[model samples]
Target chain A: MQTPNTYRAGPDPDGHFGLYGGRYVAETLMPLVLAVEEAYNAANADPAFKAELDYYLKYYVGRPSPLFLAERLTRHFGGAKIYLKREELNHTGAHKINNVLGQVLLARRMGKRRIIAETGAGQHGVATATACALFDLPCVVYMGATDIARQQPNVFRMKLLGAEVVPVHSGTATLKDALNDALRDWVAHVDDTFYVIGTVAGPHPYPAMVRDFQCVIGDETRSQLHEAEGRLPDTLVACIGGGSNAMGLFHPFLDDPSVRMIGVEAGGSGIATGKHAASLNGGLPGVLHGNRTYLLQDDDGQIIDAHSISAGLDYPGIGPEHSWLNDLGRVEYVSITDREALDAFQLCSKLEGIIPALEPAHALAHVAKIAPALPRDHLLVMNMCGRGDKDIFAVADHLGVKL
Target chain B: MRERGYWLALAMSRIEKRFAALKAESRAGLIAYLVAGDPDLDTSTKLFEGVAAAGADLIEIGMPFSDPMADGPVIQAGGLRALQNGMTLRKTLALVRHLRARDADTPYVLMGYYNPIYRYGAEAFAEDAAAAGIDGLIIVDLPPEEERELADPAERAGLDLVRLATPTSDEHRLPTIVKRASGFVYYVAIAGITGTRSADADNVHRAVSQLRRFTDLPIAVGFGIKTPEQAAEVAKAADAAVVGTALVDRLAQNLDSAGKPKPGLVDAVLADIAALASGIRTVRK
Candidate 1:
C-alpha cells in the first residue's frame, strides 16, 4: 500500500513514525521534553553547532574509522566479498562516542551542569563518562545490579572517569530497569541535569536526535565504499538492541534502493524457546521508555525480561525507528541465537584477528549464513560496531575457558 | 450535541457528586488507592470495602504491572505481591464489579500503566470497565499527547479519563491538558515518585491556584501526602487529596515475617484511612 520511498522521511512533526514513536511520558516530563525538542531544533539548524560536532568527531573521537576488507572471512564464506566498518577503533572502542560527543555539546549549550545516562554493557556509560569528563560536567550513570556485577571493568571505567555508577535493583535489574531509573532521575532533576539516552530510543527528539548524531557512520561509509568498491555495497548489516548502531548505519542509506539493510537481533537461547532479545522477531509493539516500539512482553502486556549472553543486547525493546522500518519493509530484521553468536565471535577472531563484541557477533552470525549463498561479486558491509575486550570474561566463562 | 452533553454529565457525575458533598461539608474528599490483589484478592477486596466504609470519598484500584516506574518502593512491592498472587486485568475488573455491587455511589478510578489495557484491547477494556461500574482511569504513562489511543473509546463508553498535572507542567501546556481532561486534575504534589517526599502545603496551594486559573476541573493533590498531617495540609487548597503509598505501606507493615497477611492487616489499613479521612475533614474546622 506504500511506496519504497515512504520509509525515508519518517517521524512527522509530532514524532509519530507511523504510530510507533510518540512522547508517552508523564506530565512531569512534558515540559522538559518540549524544551529538549526546541533546543535540539535550534542546534540542528545552526551551522556553528554542526562545525563543532564535526571538530570533536574528527579530533577527539576519531572519525572515518577504516573500512577493513575481511579477505579471510570472504574466503571462509566462499561467496560475497565482506568489508568490516571498524567502529571498534573509535575513542571509546565503540560507536557510542559519536553520539555522546554531540549530546554532551548540546547539553553544554543548554547550560546543563550535570549529565545522567543509563547503560547495559557499560560501553555507553564509558562513552558518556568520557564525554562528561572532557566537557567538565558532573556525570551519573545508572546500571542494573546484575550488570554491575557482570560488567566490572566498565563499572571501573566509569568510576575512573569520575562518574558515579548507580546500580538499579528494580524490575528485572537489566537495561530496562536502568533506563526507568534514569528517567526518574531526569524527572526529579530536570532543572540542572541532561539525560543522555544511550540508544536511538526514548521520546521525541531523542530517537531522531540520536539518529542524526549517529548517521555519521553511514555518511562516511557511502563515500568510503564508493572510493573503494566503485559503487555502493549490495547489503548492510548491524546488530540491534536499542538499535543505535544499526540506525546509524541504516539511516543515510534508506533511499538507496540497491542497498539492502539487515538488522540482526539477539535470539538468546532461541526465538522458539521464548528466551530472546529479538524484539522485532519475537515481540510485539507496545509502549515503554517514553515511546511506542517493539517490546518483549507477556500476553497480559507486562514486560518480560530479555535474555542474551551479550549485555548490550539484553534489552526488552528496540528503537522506535526500527519498528517503523520493519513495518515499512524497508529493512529486513533477523535473529541469531547465543550459541551462533558465540561461534561467530570465535570464528571472526581466528579468521580476521578481529575480536568482535557479542553484540556485533550476532550480525556476523547472520552474515555467515546468507553470504555463502550469494554470488562472489556481491559486496556485504557489516558494522564491527564494538570491540570484544569487555566481553572476554563472559565469553571465556561460556566456553569453559575459566577466565 | 445534547447526547454528548448527557454522556459527559453522566460520566462526570460520580466524581462531581463526591466533590460537591465535600464542598457542602467544607472539607476535601479523601481518595484512597490499593493494589487490586495485594497479598491476595479476597483480602484486598475486604480492604477496599473497609476503605469506603471508613469514609474515603473515592477509591483508586491499582492494576499492578511488572514494572511500575512512577511508584516508590512501598507501592512497587505491593504491585509485585499482587502479581505473584495471580492478579490479572480481567480479575481486576471482576473485583471492581464485586465492589460496585456493594456500594454504587463512590467514584472508583483504575490507576496504573497503559500496557495492560492496551493488551486487553482499548474498546473492549472500555466496554468492560464501564460495565463493571468503573468511574474513571488514570494511566500514569499515557500522557495527553498520546491519549487518543484510549481516550476516545473511554469517552464513548461514558468513562472519564483523568489527567495528571505536575510541577513541570507549565502554563503553556496546562490549557491543552485541561481541555481534554475529565473527572478531575490529579496534581502530583512532589516532582519525585510516589511516597518519596512530602509536598510543602504552601507550594501545593500555589500550584493548585495556578491550575484553577485554567479549568474549573476539581484538583486532587497526590504523590507524598502520606500521613494524616500531610493530608490535612493538602486539604486546605485541593478539592481532594489522594493517599496511596501510606495505605499500601500499612498493608505491608501488617504482614507477617513470611509476607502473609496477619490477623489485623485489613483493619490496620482501614484505621489509617479513617485517620487520613478525619485529618482531611479538619480543613472545615
Candidate 2:
C-alpha cells in the first residue's frame, strides 16, 4: 500500500496541479477552506490517522480490488491486451467509497460531527451516507433536483443510511447546482460540519488529499498488472467527470514514461457539434468550484451548462490536475459522443459480459475507436470504475427501448 | 452644469463623515456598496470619491464573488468582470489604503462573501483590513450564528459587524439578530435569489415600516432597489437604500468586446446613480 504521505496536498502554496488549481470560490468559504487545508495538513501526517484510514480501506472498504485481464475483449479488438481495474467490485459498488472512507475518517479525527456532500450521480452521496452510518455521524447530501429524480436509487440508498438528502433547485438543477447548495450548507454549518467533497476538485488539500486516498486504485492497478503481465501497461484509460476515478487510476502511472494515459469525456452530441462536457477538448482555463481548471465557459467566462447521458459526467469543469496534465502534454483527453458511449455500453456487456457504468462506458467506447489501430502485443488498461446497474433505465431510455 | 469630479466630490464627503463618528454613533450606520476595481479602478477610485462626495455614510467596497447567489445577473456579471480585471481582495483593500491617505475620516467597509477572506486568515484579515483603512465588515453568508469565529476578532480590531435581517426572520430571531449586529441591519426584501425586479412599490414600503419596530438601528432594504422610482418608495420607510445589483449591472453593460470597462460606460452609470440619489429625499414625519 502507498503511504498516506505519498499524496500530501500542500508544498504548492498557490494551489496548483503543477501550476493549476487555485482558490476560486466565493469569498465566503475562504476561511473555512483555509481551516480545512490546515486540518488536512496536520491530520495527513498523524500516524493514527494513517492507520485508521488503512484499516477502513482494507477491512471495511475491501480495497486492493483485483486487476483482471480482459483477454477475450482484447482478442476481439485485435489490438493491445486489455486489463480492467475492478473498482466495480469495491464495497458500495464503485471507486467512490475509497475516497468517502478516507474523508469520513479524516472528519472523525478532526472531531467533526456532521458530513455534507454534493452528488450528481448520487454515488458520492451514497458513499458519504454509508460512511456516516458506519461512524454514527450525521450526514447531509445536496443533490440537484434533476438528479434526485434520475439517480433515485442512490438517493434512496443515502436515505436508508439515515442521511438527509437536500434537493437543490437552483441554477440548472444538476451537479453544479448541488455543489452550490453544498457550499451554502457548509458555510451555514462550518463549525461542526466536514464537507466530504466527492471528487478531485475544490480548493487546496481537497484536490490533493482526495487524489492521495484514491491513488490506491492506481497503485493496486500498477502492481496487479505487473504481476499479471510482467510489465507496465502501455496505455491507461479512464472517464472524466470531476476526474476522480481517472486520477485514482492515473496517479501511479503518471511517472511511467511508456504509459499513455487517456481521459475520455462526455461529448453529449459531439465536441464538434458543441453540446458536450468535454472540457479538455473544448474549454478554456477558467475558475469554477474552487480551482482554476479547464472549464466549459463562454467568452465572458459564464459557466456553460454541460450535457451528458450520464448525470455524473455532465459537469462543465474538469479537475484542476487534469487541466495541468493537459497543459503539460502528459495526458490527452478524447471525446466519446453519447451515441458512441451508449453503443460501447452494449458492446462491453455483450462481448465482455460486463455492464459498465455509463461514465466509464465513455472511456470503453474510446477503446473501440483507438484500440484496433494499436499493435496486439501492446497492453491497454481501462479502469472499470463502476457498475452500470444504476444506469439501466437511462441507457434504455437513450435507446428508446424498454428496460 | 457639473464637472467630472463634481459627483466624485460628493461621494468623498459622505465617506469622510461616516468614519468620523463610526465609534460614537449608536444608531447602526449604513455602508454603501459599489464594485471595487470596476470600470477600471481609476473610475472605481473616482466612484469611491463620488460615494464619499454623496454622503454615502459608509463605504462597502464589494470584493466580487463569481457566483453571487443573492445577486441578479447584472451584479453577477459585474463581479465576474471585476475578477477578470485582476481585482483581488488584496487589491481592493489596497484601494482603501489609497483612499485612507487622502481622507482619513470616512470608515471603509469591506463587504463581500467569505472565500477571499478565508484565503487571508480571519484574524489576520481583520488586522490587515484595518491596516488597509477598512473600518467595518458585512459578510452576507456569515450570520449571527456563525459570528463568534469571525465577528469577535473583527470587533476586537474596532471594525463593526453588519448583519442582515431578511423578511423570513421571525420575531424571536429578529431581536436576537438585531442584538448581535454591531452595525446597521440589512433587510433583504422579496428574495427568491437576487438581481430580479420587484413588482410592487407598496410592498417594499410596508416591509420597511415593519422592520423599524425591531430596533432603533438604521434599517436599509436591498435586493431590488434599482431605479429612482424604486429608491423613492424605499426611502419613505428605510433609513438608507442599498443599490448594488443595479449599479453593478450598469458597469457590466458598459464592458467592451474584450470585457474591459469602457470609459463611456462609467460616465453613463455615474450619471444614472446621481439621478437616483437626487430623486429620493429622506422621509419627513
Candidate 3:
C-alpha cells in the first residue's frame, strides 16, 4: 500500500478551467456558490477538518483500497501490464461513495439539514442516501423516470436508506432531466438545501469540489504504481461520464508528463451515426447544466439527446476539466461504442472474474484496442470505477443472451 | 402598460407604435410562436412577415436552447427540428434584425431558457437581443426570485423581463411576480408540463381572476391550450391567450415528407393561429 499525496491546484483564480469554466449561474445562486467556495477554501486548510476526514476514511469507509496487478488479463489483451485500482472494494460497490462521504461530511460541517442529489445509474443517489442516513440529515434523490425503471435495485436501496426518490418525467426522462429538477430544487431552497452534486459537472464549486474529493484515486494510484513497479505507470485510462472517476484517478498523474492519460467516453453506436454520448469526440464547445464543456449539440447549439447501453455514461456533456485537458493536450479522449464496451465487459468477466461496470468496460475496451500496440515494459493503470452487478441486465439484453 | 417603458422604449419608434395598437384592440390578441430559423435564414424573414400579416399581436420567437425543460414534447421536437435545419442564436438574432427592416410593430419576444442566455452573458445577450429588434424575453426556467439577474440587464437594454406565474404561486408571491413582469403576466393554467390540450375554463378563469386582482397588467393564460373554444374560454377571463405547442407542433407535423424541409409550414401555422385568435373572439362575442 502507498500513501496518499495531497496536492491541490485549481480554477486559476476566477473559477475558470483554462477558459472552460466560470460562474455561469443565476445571480441568486452566486452568493451561495461563493460562500461554499469560501467555506471549502477555509475548511480544506483546517487541520481539524482534515483529521476528521482522514479518520473516517480509515475507520468508516475503509480507505486505501487495494492496487492489484492483473497478470492474466494483461497477457490476454497482449498489451502493456495492467494494474487495477480496486475502488470496487469500497463501500457501496463503486467510486461514488468516496466523493459522497467527502461531500456529506462537508455538508455536515456547513450546518446543512437537507441534502439533495441527482443520479443517472443511481450509484451516486444511493451513495448520497447512505451518507445522509449515516449523518442523520434528510436526503432527497431525484432520478429520471427512465433511469428509475432501469436501475430499480439502486432506487430501492435509496428508499430503504430513507431517502425520498423523486421521479423526473421531463425531456427524455433521463440524467439531464434529473439534473434540471435537482437544480430547480436547489434554486427554490438554496437557503436550506446543500445539493450534493454527484458528478463533476454543475457550476463552479461542484466540479472543483467533487474533483478534489475524488483526486484521492489519482493520489493513491500514483504512489501505489511507484512502489509496486519501482516507477509510475506509462499510461492511465478511465471512463468519462461527467468525468468524476476519471478525473479522480487522472489529477495526480497530470504533472507526470511521461505517464500518458486517456479518458474513454461512451459511444452508443458510433459518432458517425449521431447516436452516441461521445461528448469529447462529437460535441462542440458549449455550456449545459452549469459548465462550459464539450456538448453533443446540433449546428444550432441545441443539445442532442445521447444514447449509451450504460446509463451511467448517457450524458451529452463532459466535465469542464476534461474539456480543458483535451484542449491543453494533457489528455486524449477515445470513444467505445456499446458493442465494444459489451465485448470488454465479457472479456474482463471471463478472464479475471472482475465483472466491471459498463462505464469502466468502455475504458477496458479502449485499453483492449491500444494495449496490443504498446511495449510490454510499459504499464497501464485503469480505474475500475464500479462493479458490474448493476449492468448484467443491459449486457444480457444487448448480447441477446437470454438470462 | 407604462411601467414596461424600459424594454418597450428600446424598440424602434415605429415598432413601438404597432405594439400600442395591439394594446388598444378588443379582439383577443394574436399569439405567435416561431422557431427562430425553420427552413433557413431566408425562410425566417418570411415566417415573421407572414405571422405579422396574419394579425399576430405578439410574436414569441423560440431562441433554441440545447435543453428546453418547460417545453412540451411537441415544442422540444420542433426546436430540435429547427436546430437540425441550421438555426442558432446568432442566426435567430439576425432574423430579428431582418424582421425589423420591414415590420416594427408586432412585439417580438424571444422565448427560451437561461443556459444559452447565461452562456452568452446576460448583458451581452440583452444588448444583442435589443439591437436585433427583440422587445422582450421569456426565459421559462428563471424563477421569480432570480428575475433580477436578467431584469437589471434587460432594463438597461430597454427590454422587458416577461415572467411566468403558475396557479401554485402563493398570495404573497403574486404581487412580486406581477411587479417584476412587463408586457404581460403569463399565467400558467396548471401545475404541469407545457403542451396543447383543452384546459378547464373555470379553473383558468379562477386563476386569471385571482391574478387580475393583484396586477392591472394584461394577464395572459397559457400552457396546453389547443382549440379555439379553449382559447375563447381563457380569453373571456384573461386579457390575452398565449398558444405555443399547438402552433409549433402543427408546423412540425406538416413538414416535407423526407423531414428535411418544412417549406411554407410557418405560413400555414400562422394562418391557423390567426384563425384561432379570430375564432376565439367570434365565439366569445
Candidate 4:
C-alpha cells in the first residue's frame, strides 16, 4: 500500500485503513453499522453538531484541560523539559468523556433512545453514564464481573449516575468479554440502542470518529507547546490499551517528521515473563471485536488473555489505526513493565503533587527513561490521561497497605 | 443482456444439490446444527452420526469460537464447553474427516466466525476443509464487503461459501449479499441472536418472500428456531429450517455433573433431531 501524502487522510469510504479496519459484524447489525457511518459523516459536516458538541464539551465536560509544566519531575530527571497534558483534571476524571459526549450527541441526532458501552476499568462506563444522565437517555454498561470486583468504586459511580451495569461472566470475564457482551446487546437492540465504543477501536466510523473527537488533546498540545516553547515538541509519549488516548495525542503530530512519538503498551510483568498486554510487542495482526488489529491470540486464533496492573489497559487487542500506524513505522511502539509504572505512579504523586492513573503512569515511566538522555531544551509531553483517585485502593493493596 | 442472477441459478453446489433433492421430494429439508466438539469429543462425535441417521437432510457444524457474540447464552455455553474439551479449528476439521469416513452422503456446512480459519491460513483451511469432505461454510462475521479475504481460496478449493441474509439486510444490500454466495442462503429468522426469541411467522414469511426477489438460491431459515412447531413454520416458506439452539439445549440437559454426557445423552439428542425432522417433513414447501 502506498503511503498517503498526509497521515490523517485514512479510513477510506469502506472503512479500511489499509486492510486493518472493517465492519466484521454479523449481518443483522450490518445495516445499522453502515447507518452509523452515514450518521457520523453527516454529523461531521453539520455546524450545529459541532456547536452543540463544543457547548457541552466546554461546559459539561470542562474542556481545554490545562497543559502544565512538570518542573519538579524535569528537575528530578535532570534532562529535557517535561509537560503533562492534565486530562485527569477533566470532568469524570479522564479523557473518555470527550468522545462519549460526541457519540451521545450523534446518537441523539440519529434518534436513538438508548445508550450502551463496554468498559474495562469503568472509566468509559462512568463517562458514558454521566453523558446519558445529562442527555436524559437510558444507559446500559457491560463490564466484566472480574473488573466489577476490582474496580468497585467506578462501578458504583456508574450506578449512581443512573446506568444499569451488566456484569459479563463470559470467557476470562475481562474487558474482551465485556466487549463481546456489548456487541451482543447492540445486535439485539439495533433499532433503539446506540453503542458508544470507549476507545479508538471497534468497526470503522468508530476509530475514526472517536479519534476525531479526541484530537482536541493533541491539537491543544500543538498550539500550547508552540506558545510556551516557540517551536514544535521533539518527542511525544502516551500509554495504549485500545489506544484511544495515544492515538488522540499522536495523530495531530503524525506529519511532523521531526517529532518522535512513542506508544507505551502495558508489559504486565515483562515480555520475557510471557505475561503482558503488549500486543505490538508480543502479538501479531488478527481480527477481534470487529476490527483487524494486533491481537494477543494463540496458534488456533483463540484470543489470549491480556494481563496488566491497569485494568484500563487489560485488552487483548489494540485499535486498528494504531496497528496501521505501527505498520507504517510512523509511531514507535514500546512497552513498560507494571513494576516500572508503579514506581512512576509514586514518583509523580510525590514530586509533582498530582497522582496519575496506572494507565498514564505507564507512559510516564517511558518518559522517565528517555528524559535523562536528552538535552534540557528538548520539549517532551506525556498525556496524564486520568487521575489516581480511582486507583488508590489498588495501589495501596499492591504496596501491602491495609486499604 | 443476460442478468447476473440468471448465472447464479445454474450453479449446483453440493449443499444446493441436497436442497434441490429435498424440494423434488415435496418436503422441506431439516438442517440440524451443533458445535463440532460439544460436551466432549466422544459425545459430539456420536452426535454427528446420530443427527445424520435421524433423517437430517443437511448438517451445519458449528466451529466453536471464544467470543461468539452472534450466539445466545445456550450456544455460547456449548461453544465454551467444546473449547474447554480442547477443540480447535484443526480438531474440528479432523472431526469432519472422521464424520466423512463413515457417512459421505450427508451435506455438511462448517459454520463459525472468521478468525480461526484466518489463523489457520485461508488457503490451507479451504483446501483442508474440502479434503475433509466438508461441503459449505457459513462464517457469521465475514460480510459480503469483506469477502475478498476468503472468496478466492474457497472457490479454488470447491467449497460453497454460504451467505446469511438477515432482516437487517435492506433491499439495496440484498443483491450484493447473494451475488457471490454459492450454497443455499441462510436467512436468519430474526434480527437478534440465536435462541432468544421465537421468530414471528409473519416476519419470516415476509423476509423470505423479499429474498426470493433477489436470487434463485435456496433459502434456509435459522436463528430463533426453538421447537419442532417453529421449525415447521419456518420450513413452510423456506427451502430448509435450521434447528440449532433447541438441539443444543437438549444436549445440555442431558450432561452429567462432571460435564460428561450421560448414558442416553446421544439417543436423547438424536430423538430431538428426529422430532424436528418429522416436523419439517410434515410441511410441504
Candidate 3, residue A317: the lDDT equals 88
Q: How far off is residue B236 in model 3, in Å?
A: 23
* Candidate number achieving the greatest DockQ relative to the actual structure: 4
TM-score of chain A of each: 0.99, 0.95, 0.96, 0.99
Ranking by TM-score: 1, 4, 3, 2
Tens digits of lDDT, candidate 1, A312-379: 99999999999988998889999999999999999999999999999999999999999999999898
**Candidate 3 per-residue C-alpha lDDT over B121-209 given as tens digits, one digit per residue, 9 for 90 to 100:** 77988999999888888877565544566899998988978767775565766776677767677777755556834567888878877
User: Each candidate's lDDT (Cα)?
Assistant: 0.92, 0.76, 0.79, 0.92
| Model 4 regions lying over 4 Å from their true place | A1-3, B1-11
TM-score of candidate 1's chain B against its reference?
0.95
Q: CAPRI band of model 1?
A: medium
Clashing pairs for predicted structure model 1, backbone only: none
Q: Least lDDT summed over 10 consecutive residues: which range in candidate 3 chain B?
A: B11-20
Per-residue lDDT tens digits for candidate 3, residues A338-368, read 9999999999999989999899999999999
Write down the worst ten-residue block by lDDT for model 3 chain A: A1-10
In candidate 3, position A348 carries an lDDT of: 94
Where does model 3 exceed 4 Å of error? A1-8, B1-60, B69-109, B113-132, B135-285
| Candidate 2 error regions (>4 Å) | A1-11, A26-28, B1-29, B32-66, B69-285
